[model samples]
Target: MQALPKTRTDGRLPLYARLRDQLASRIANGEWSPGDMIPSENRLAEEYGVALATMRMALKQLVDEGLLERRRGTGTFVKQPAFRADLFRFFHVHDVEDPDGPVIPESRILSRQEVDLPPEVKRAFGDDAGGRCLKLERVRLWAGDPLLFEEIYLRLPDFDGLMSLDPKEMGPLLYPVFLQKFGILISSATDELSFGTATQASAKYLELPANSPVAVIERIARNPVGRIIEYRRVHGRPERFRYRVNLGEQHT
Candidate 1:
C-alpha cells in the first residue's frame, strides 16, 4: 500500500488540515470504500511522525465533514458521501410542512425535556437565555420505511404548547404547527450538508447494513425578525436523496 504523506510545516495551514485534504482526495479517488476501517490515530501519527493531537485534529476535521465515523468501541471507518445541497435557499424535509408533500415521515419522540442550553445551541438561539427550549428527536420514514433520524431543538416561546402535543398529532408539518399555535413565521434557514456513516442506532432504525454510509445535515432556521427558532440535525441514506441548487449571475 502507498504510505501516507509526511507532515508539512509551511504554516499557511495546519498540518492536520493538510492530512485531512489528502485523505479526502484519496477517498474521492475510490481508495477507500464504505465500511472500510481507517488507520488508527496512533498509526497516522507515527506515519506522519507528528504528535497524537495533530493526528486527532485531522481526524476530527474529517468526522465533522462526515467523511469518517468514530464508534465508541470500534475504530474510525469510512463514511458514505452525500449529495451537496445549495445554501442559497431554504429546504425542509418533504412532509414537515408542505401539504402537497408525502406523509410518509413518522416520529418516535425519544425524549422531551427542558435543559440549560449548551453553549453552542444557546449562541445559535440568540439572546434568550431566560427562555427555555424543547428538544425533540424522531426517526423519519419514506413510504413507511425508515429514511432518516432527526433531532430538533426549538425555542420554547415560539412553540408554547410543544410539550402537550402527542407525537402522532404533530402532523406532517412542524412549521405550520408553530405558526398556528404561536404566530411564528419561519422566514429563512441555513444548512450545512456532508457525508457521514450511520450510528449503530441510526443504522438499526434505517435498517441499513452495519457501517453503511449516510448523509448528515445540520440546519438552523430563523424567523423574519432574525431570531433563530429551530436547530436540527438529520442523518439519512445517502443513496436515496440529492440536494439540488440553482445559482444566479453575480454583478460585476
Candidate 2:
C-alpha cells in the first residue's frame, strides 16, 4: 500500500485525482515506457491500497486523455505516438520520384547549448519551468538542397544529459530520441503555419536571398499529460512547401 502525496493539501481533491497525479508522475519518470503493458487494475488497486472502482476511475481518466490504451483480452499499455504519419502531415516531405510517398529529410544539427529561454517559450512551459533551456539549431536537406532551417527549444532538466550525445547519432526525428533515451513521450503537437519573410539567419542557412518569403511553422509539442516539452520554429522555402487536405465523406 502506498500513500498519495498531500502536496495540494486541499480536502476538495478526490482520492482518485491524487492517484491519477501519482500514476502520471510515474509515467513521466519512465517507470513504464511506451508500448509496455502496465500492471492490471486489480494489481494496481492492491498496490495503491485503493478500492477497485477507485483505481478503475483513475486509470479511466488517463485512458480518456490518451496516455494509456486498453486491449480487450490483454491489458493496458502506454500509448505510442504515430510519429511517421504525424510528421508527414506536418513536414510534407516526399520522394521526388514518388510524390505521394513520405520521406524524411536528411538533418544536420548546427548547434546545441543551454540558453536563456525566450519569453514565449517560457510561457508555454509554464511558470514552474526554469529560465534556461536547451536550444538546438538544425537544417533539413533533401536532394542536396536545404529545405528547412529550424530553431528548436526544449525544457531543461527533462533533457539534461542530451548535450553530451553526438548530434550525428540523433538522426532526423527528435521524438523517438525523447522517448527511447529520456522516457518522455510526445503525445501531440499543435503547429501554426504562416508565410513570412526570412530573417538573416534563416536566409543564410536556407540559401535564400535576404527577406525571401518562406513557409513558417511554429510548433508546440506536449507529453501525454499535456506538459509542453518542445517549441520549434521552422522556416522552409515557399516553393517547396505543399499542403494537402481532403474534406467530406469522399476523402474518407
Candidate 3:
C-alpha cells in the first residue's frame, strides 16, 4: 500500500483530532466512497508513523460520528446516512395488505408563493433567517387519497428558482431536489411529533373533518454545517400514523 500522508497539524488541534478531521474530510469529499472498506488500523498506523493507539482513537472518533463502521471480521467501511430509516420512521404511507411493503406517495404542490417570514420560521433558520422566505403548501397522496398535508418554508435566495419547477418534476421527495437543484445536501434532520387539531387548510387538503385530531410533525433539515435549510410542518391523520421503534441495549 502507498504511504498514507501525514495528517496536517496547523497547531490548533491535537494530533489525533487532526487525523480524525482529515479522515472525515476525505470521506466528505468522496476520496473514499460509500460501502468501500478503508485501510486497516495497522496499515494506517504504519503509514502515518503514528502509534496504533493514536490511530485507533482517530478511527473510533469517526465511527462514533457514524462516518465509519467497523465489523467484527470485516474491515472498516464508509457509512452512508440512512435516509430510508427516517422515512419509514416518520412518513405516513403504508400498504394495508402488505404492511412491510413500500409505498411511494404522489406529490402535489398546492401553492408556491413568497411569504412573510413567521417568527417560528425565522427561529428555525437561526441567524440565516431573514424578513422573507418562500412558503410551499403541498400534499402527499396514496392511491389518489391525500395522506399528509405539508407546509414547507425555505430561506429566500437559497431556493429562489425552486418556485418555477413543475410539481411532477419535483418527485415524491424534496431532499433530492435540494441536492440536484440547489447543490445542498441534508446532513441531518430533527422531527418533533405531536397531536394537534387539524387546521382549516389541513382539513381542506387532507379531507379531514373540521378540527379533527391530527398527527403533527415538525421537521427541520440542516446542511453539514448545521445551517437550517428547510422547515416543514406536516399534518397527517392520526389513525394513519404508525410509529415503531426497535430497542436494543441502551447506553447511558
Candidate 4:
C-alpha cells in the first residue's frame, strides 16, 4: 500500500479527507497537470489499500472543488481553466489609430536565474515554499519604445529548467510557454495596481529618469488547483497605462 506522508497530512482527519488532501497536494506539486487523466478509482483504491468507495468519495470531493473532472466514459482529468488565454490581456499594447486592436509587444529577457526569494515574496508563497526560486527580468517594447519593465518570480522545482530556455523563442506571451514547457496552467491571477516612483533599474529599462512616477502592477498567478505559481511586479510608463472596466448586469 502506498502510504500518505504522515508529516504532511493531518492524522486526525477522516481517511477520505486525508486522501483528498493528498491528491490535492499532488496536483499542487505538479504531479498531474491540466488535462492529464488520473488513475481509475479501483486502481487508486488498490494502490492506496483503501476501499473503492473511499477512493470515489475522495475523487468526488476534488471534482466538486473544480480541481478534477470525470470524462463521460474515459477517466478523470485535471480541470483546465477557460480564462487562461485572457490572463495577460491587461499587459497587451494597443495601436493608437486602432484602439480596439491589441498588439503584442516585443519581449526582451534581460536575466533569468535561481535566487533567494525576498521575505515578503516568500511569505506570499506560503511557509512550505523553499528559500529560493526562479527570477526573471524582462522588458516589453512597442514600436521600439519601452512600455514596461517586469520582475517575475516563480516557484522552484515546479519551474525547474526554465532558465535553460532561450528567451528569443518565448516571444511576448509567457503563459503559453509555461503550459507547453512546464505543464503548468495559470488559471487565475489577481493584479493590484498602484503608482510608484521608478527605481534606477526600472528607469533604465523604461527610458525614464530615476524617481519618475510610474504605474505599478503586482500580480499573483495560480494554477487550476489554486496553488500559487508565479508572482510578478511590473512598472509601466504612466502615460501608456490605461484601465477600463464595465459594470452592471449583463443581458443576452
What C-alpha RMSD separates each model from the true structure? 19.9, 3.5, 5.6, 4.8
Candidate 3 lDDT trough over 10 residues, lowest sum: 1-10
C-alpha lDDT (0 to 100) for residue 232 of candidate 2? 93
Arranged by lDDT with the best first, the candidates are 2, 4, 3, 1
Give lDDT tens digits, candidate 4, residues 1-252: 899765233489889988887787677667888778999999999998999999999999989978899989899998875533232355546668997755667789999999999886897798768989999999988889988899999999888888888777687889878877877777668889989999999999999997999998899988644678899999989887777798899888
Model 4's TM-score against the true structure: 0.69
- Give residue 179's error in model 2 in angstroms: 2.4
lDDT of each: 0.68, 0.84, 0.79, 0.82
lDDT of 1 by residue, 1-252 (tens): 335453334447667777776666555444665568988888878877778998899889878866688988889987643312222122334544675643344546666777667666777876664556788877765557766777788886656578887777767557656654565545457778888888887788778988888888888976532457788878787667666767798788
Highest-lDDT candidate: 2
Off by over 4 Å in 2: 4-19, 49-54, 85-92, 96-102, 249-252
- In candidate 1, stretches whose alpha carbon ends up further than 4 angstroms from where it belongs are 1-110, 130-132, 209-211, 245-252
Best by TM-score: 2
- Runs in model 4 lying further than 4 Å from the true structure: 1-32, 36-92, 95-103, 249-252
For each candidate in turn, the TM-score is: 0.52, 0.83, 0.71, 0.69
Higher lDDT: candidate 2 or 4? 2
For model 3, what is the error of residue 138's alpha carbon versus the real structure, in angstroms, after optimal superposition?
1.1
